[model samples]
Target: MRDSFHHRLDVLVLQLARMCDLTAVAMSRATDSLATGDARLAEGVVADDVIVNQTRTRIEQDAQTLLALQSPVARDLRVIVTVLRSAEHVERMGDLAHHVALAVLRRHPDPVLPAPLRSRFQLMGSIAVRMAGTTGKVVRERDPVLVRTLDAADAEMNELHRSLFQVIGHRWAFGIPAAVDASLLSRYYERFADHAVAVAARTAFIETGTPALI
Candidate 1:
């Protein structure tokens, strides 16, 4: 019985890690769709979001079952609880990617980003994707040190996000519509990084018992 219960716990952790991987792929493809205005890729990213959502649901269900049946305490309880919270953050990351893809679809043949702002948004997306990849490792290993790296990544993303406003406010001649779209898209990438950071923070809390605000 103990062995079977332990196996279930392992499965939950693995599922959470796998979910992170899925979100990373989503973000990458979404980024590509945004940069190139690929409607088909954008649609695919939007469709795959259901899979990400389903993964989160499965993780939550399995973790809850373990909580009820195994009566886990101490580190085991910490792992399960943190897994649920991490799953939430990771899933949100997926949603942000989906939002980015939807923006691409909304714009259709017209490019979503202006010429000046395209590189910035692309960099932000890259940071988000990197954070998601690292988050998977953190989820599986629960390493506090690895979480710190994600923290650094989130900071970079924030800087890039702020830079987007600088362009739109002064230099942008793309008019209000384009500016608004850029602002929202920048927010999406920023939030994507934020969610990745939050997931890593949860992994850190598993070890250090620190509650991260972001």
Candidate 2:
């Protein structure tokens, strides 16, 4: 029974990694759609979100089963609890990606981001993708060093988010709609990075039993 429990735990980690991968892909494609005015790619991101949701459900059920059947204690229990929480964070990241795609779909051929803001949004997208990829590594390796990097990455995202406001504050030719989209898009990317940091922090806590502050 103990061996079986460990096996399930291993499976749980693999499942979480899979979720991270899907979320990363979604973030990447959604950004591409926004940058290029590709409605189809944006639609694809929206459609694929169902897979992320299903994976989260599987991770949750597996963690719950481990808790109920194995009665994990100490680090084992922490691992299960952390997995449950991290799954939610991952799911929320997926939703943020979906929101980005929806913005693209809503705007269609006419790019949601203003021409001047395109490069900034692209940079934000790149950072978000990098963060999502690192999140997968953190979940699998649970390295304190990698976990710390996530906090820095999230800080970068916040800085970029602030820059978006600065851009909006200046003379804007794209009008109110563009400003609104830019604000929401910036927020989505920031939130996506935030969730990635949350997942990394939870993984660190599970490994070291020390809660990470960002």
Candidate 3:
């Protein structure tokens, strides 16, 4: 009986980790659509959000069910809580992806980004996607060292985001539209990476026997 219960619990955790990976991929697609002005890709991203929402709901339900049925203790309890929190992170990541798609749709086929600004935005998005993938890996493997490595990569994204803002402030010569759009895209990428880092930190805590602040 004990073994079966833990087996189910591990399956649930793995499912949530997979959901996080799917959301990260969706976010990457959304950013690509934005950078390339690919209307088809943007539309595809918007359409695929249904899967993200459904997966999040199912993961939450599973977490609740496990908690109620098993009355888990210690590490089991921590795993349940981590699964719940990770679901939220994955759902929010999907929302960010949709927002990026909407930004692309809003701009339509027109070149929505300035050359220099788009270049920087692309760099930021790439880093954010990579960090998100790392977060998923950390959760799946329960590796504290891998999580810490992701944390470092996340710091680089933060620096890039800050530098992007500085460039926007100084590049007044590019006019208001350029600065505003660049700022919006940078904000999205920054928030995405921040959430990824949070996931990594939380997963690290769960795996390493560290206390969760939540």
- For candidate 2, what is the TM-score? 0.96
Q: Which lDDT value does model 2 have at 3?
A: 87
Who wins the TM-score comparison? Answer: 2
Q: 109-188 in candidate 2: lDDT tens per residue?
A: 78798778888888888899999989999899888898788888899899999987877887877899989999999999
Tell me the RMSD of model 3 versus the true structure.
1.9
TM-score (C-alpha) between model 1 and the true structure = 0.95
Tens digit of per-residue lDDT, candidate 1, span 110-138: 99887777788778888888889999999
What TM-score goes with each of the models? 0.95, 0.96, 0.92
Residue pairs of candidate 3 with colliding backbone atoms: none
Distance from true location, Cα of 167 in model 1, Å = 0.7
Q: Estimate every model's Cα lDDT from 0 to 1.
A: 0.88, 0.90, 0.79
Query: Between candidates 2 and 3, which one is better according to TM-score?
Result: 2
